[model samples]
Target: MPFTPFHMGAGLAAKAAIDRHFSVLTFGIAQIAMDIEPLIGMIRDADVLHGPTHTYIGALAIGFAVILVSPFICRPILRRYNYEARAMRASWLACPEHLSKGAVALGAFIGTLSHVLLDSLMHADVRPFWPVSNSNPLLGLVSVDAVYQLCFWLGAASAIAWLVGKYRHGRENG
Candidate 1:
């Protein structure tokens, strides 16, 4: 799957919303990219799939699935982070009262969904409205090229560095 800054951005945003569910967001983007690029390749003779997965349904389904399983997969991490054991259990059970439950679910869903929508906006001919219509709309300014990839890597690195710096500053001040 092509690594686009669109998806990377979504993943980063997801981290803020879900408190570290970027993996699910990025993974969902990759998954959707893999599924769509091949089909897009077949139709456009480009040798990749980049169509259906960019649709709204794809985003919803994948996002829902990822969010649904997040608590289970991240249980240990949550515990490590000092989440109450009972709260964690309730989140795992999808209880509304769990402190971070909604945030976690929304984070995963939004992050994954954002990747799909963001990719849709960037491509020249994405079936984002697929099963509904097939109009090629261009909503992005950057082309999926090496330059864009560089920007993504640099942005992610910068965000990481800034976060690390802030953490260290806080520690030192404390």
Candidate 2:
């Protein structure tokens, strides 16, 4: 699932449910951060496609990195998007000008850990508990088709829910 939109589906669902507690931009950054090692491995044609970076230990490290950098990255992005939304008179869709440190950390941790968990189910090379054991107990936990369907359905359901919530809220406020 490296470089795939499947991961974003989970992120979207999370954002829909916890928009105030989680920064979607930070979550997205963590997702990209998690995949960078695998992308490099794919380009280098390394024997292990999903190497140490796909492990829980590696995810913790990556999550820390995301927390450190996400403020810098997410702030500018949110500022610009918020500016555009304000200009367009769509404030409800805008993000905060400054994200809290807690939100960044939470999003990063959730994003990276979820990425590892999901990949571990599909990719036999993903040893999520590595450094303790190379055995991938999560491999084949679910079929690839089921994984895709889960991601897609979760995303669809979340999107619908978010939209409905926003619509109802808007009607009440307006």
Question: Which candidate wins on TM-score?
Answer: 2
The global Cα lDDT (0 to 1) of model 2 is: 0.86
**1-174 per-residue lDDT for model 2 (tens digits):** 888878777877877887778777888899899989888998999888888889999999999999999999887798899799879987666666788888888889988999999999999789999899999898898999999899889888887877777657666776
TM-scores, all candidates, are 0.56, 0.92
lDDT of each: 0.53, 0.86
Cα lDDT of model 1 by residue, 56-137, tens digit: 7776776676666665655555455444634555223121223365666565566555655555655665677778777646
- Model 2: residues with Cα > 4 Å off, grouped in runs: 170-174
Q: Candidate 1: deviation at residue 42, Å?
A: 10
Q: RMSD of each candidate?
A: 7.8, 1.6
